[model samples]
Target: MNADNNLYQLYQSIELENVILSYKGEFTSELLTALIHILEAKMEELGTDFRVRKRVFNVIIECFQNLYHHIDFYDFRNEKLEVRKPALIIVKYKDGDFIVNTGNYVMTKDVPKLEKRLSFINTLNKNELRELYLEQLNKGKISSQGNAGLGLIEIARKTKEKLIYNFVKKDSKISFFSLKVVVGN
Candidate 1:
């Protein structure tokens, strides 16, 4: 399709999906702080309940951190052009519920482990998720980077919904991992 047509198609898709906010670019701490303020203001303007707003904000933080910490930053020097940083965040509202979606690039080798972790989190009920979250928190299994590994569980517990995710192969060595969480008003 032509450039204009492609842009129009993207607009149509976002509208169809009820997207309130969408961003795709590099993730920096400064940018994330600004975005969080913007999101909070938007949610307030939209008359979102405090509880739901809080849940969405927390999930967004977790998703953003996941992108920042776990993303693979392999050099693509062989390519002539700079690849768009494979990071995206979208917030959509429908039927009194909000859905937060995030996408980031990950090493292909990590996909299976991630899929398994998400799958297990998805299978847990609220209490079970809470238990796991606390267990992990108490165990304090810190990574070299100081991550406690409770992000996914906390997202699931707060949203009270199964995490939805998909991994699409971007190349031989990397894949795009997308995750979605929904919060009801």
Candidate 2:
């Protein structure tokens, strides 16, 4: 299809998916805050119940923070990209469930470690997840990026869904890491 037609097709898909918010760019603290505000307003506009909105809001924050912090981990290495490619993020409400997804580039070598982590988290039940969260919290380990390594656990605990993730190799050196979390009744 032509470029315009391609764009139109993607737009139609997004609308049909009931996407509430979408952004694909470098995320900064200010931008994250702004996005949260926009989504909160959108939820209010849709008359989302207070409790549901709160849960969805918490998951969105964790997702955005994970995206933002992980990006900088490779900032020193990925500077050679064509023009500092931006990451992709989308939030949609479908079939009464809120889905948040984010994708960013990662070094191919690091994919295994991340994939393993998520795989383990997906195997846990709600109680197991709660236990793991507490264990990590008590350990008090912090990465150089100031992350306590609890974002995924927290997201799982809040959403109570198996995080859907994929790593598509973009080139010899880099891959695109995509993650999806769904929360609903």
Candidate 3:
């Protein structure tokens, strides 16, 4: 009964929030591609401007990459729960702006570095972000997973919006990291 009511409240909230898409499950390349297509159709239906649609797609791809690459399942501390730590992606359109929110579990120890990096990114203007993105590209340090560590930077540059995040401790070792990015003026 409680769960039903909770879900009902959630449904009501989603309605009020103007959410266009919401997914909370394990992420994969195929699923990500499907999500992009779904949003592409939505943009088409709404007659979104070409430039704004491009920005929206760029930001969503980056967010999906972060979810795909940065999940820290090792910190889950339970073999039973290690199958797949589900992540979340929520897209909302409100007042001519599209808001994206992605959440995933991360190792608590990584919180400080992530917080610092995002804080620095938030402080930079569009010009500075471009410079930093180019500098990072020049460095060319790609991870084993093939990430060049430029997803956040690219998101910020494309959106020209501050990256908003919150780290909520889930346990002693694992925390939920939620990031929100806004695209369109």
Candidate 4:
């Protein structure tokens, strides 16, 4: 889902009512920084309160980092091969709510596990989410990708909203995961 230069420009140019910040290419440190800066500027222009902005930033950082650390990308050029993992994020800022969508490739076998995690997180109340997050953090153990699923739980708690997800088929072996969270002021 690579974006053309024109579309990217249009996205940057307009003061969108429902702004959708999408990342569909290589997820380098540089790209991630640029996205965060632009999003911050846009939120500032929208007159968002400091608390809301802080929460939004935290969610964005965690979401993007999770994708960056967990995804793998492969490249083949001139009979040489290189691999990299890329993450795609789409953040939509709508009236009274911010919708964050992020996606990354995952092994086919991991689908059920991810789904279960999402389901569990979505069902928790604020107190339960906080308890779960503290529990995970106090344990001080990290996952294979250096994550403890706290990001998802944090998004759920901060938003006080449901987390919606979709799995799109990318190929025989890999799948694209889309997660959307809405935080309302």
Tens-digit lDDT string for candidate 4 (59-101): 8877777676664323321124243556677777777577887
- The sequence of per-residue lDDT tens digits that candidate 2 reaches over residues 1-185 is 59999999999998998998899889888997898899889888878878778888888888888878877767766667665657888999887788988888878999999999999999999999999999999987898778998889999987847889999998888899999888876
Better of 2 and 3 by lDDT: 3
lDDT minimum window of 10 residues, candidate 3 = 70-79
Q: Write the residue-wise lDDT of candidate 1 on 1-185 in tens digits.
A: 59999999989999999998888887877877888898888888889899998888888888888777654334343254356455899999988798998988777888899899999888899989988988999986888766789889989988856888999998877788888899885
lDDT tens digits by residue: candidate 3, 1-185: 99999999999999999999999987877988899899999889888888989999999999998887765434345566645678999999987889999998887898999999999999999989989999999997998778898999999987746888899998887899999999985
Model 3 spans with C-alpha error above 4 angstroms: 1-8, 72-83
TM-score of each: 0.87, 0.90, 0.89, 0.79
Report the error of model 3 at residue 143, Å.
Answer: 2.3
Q: Kindly provide the TM-score of model 1 when superposed on the true structure, using C-alpha atoms.
A: 0.87
Model 2 deviation from native, Cα RMSD in Å: 2.0
Model 3 per-residue lDDT at 147: 89
Best by TM-score: 2
Backbone atom clashes (below 3 Å) for every candidate: 0, 0, 0, 4
**Deviation (Å) of 122 in candidate 3:** 0.9
**Worst ten-residue run, lDDT, model 2?**
76-85
At residue 73, give the lDDT of candidate 4: 26
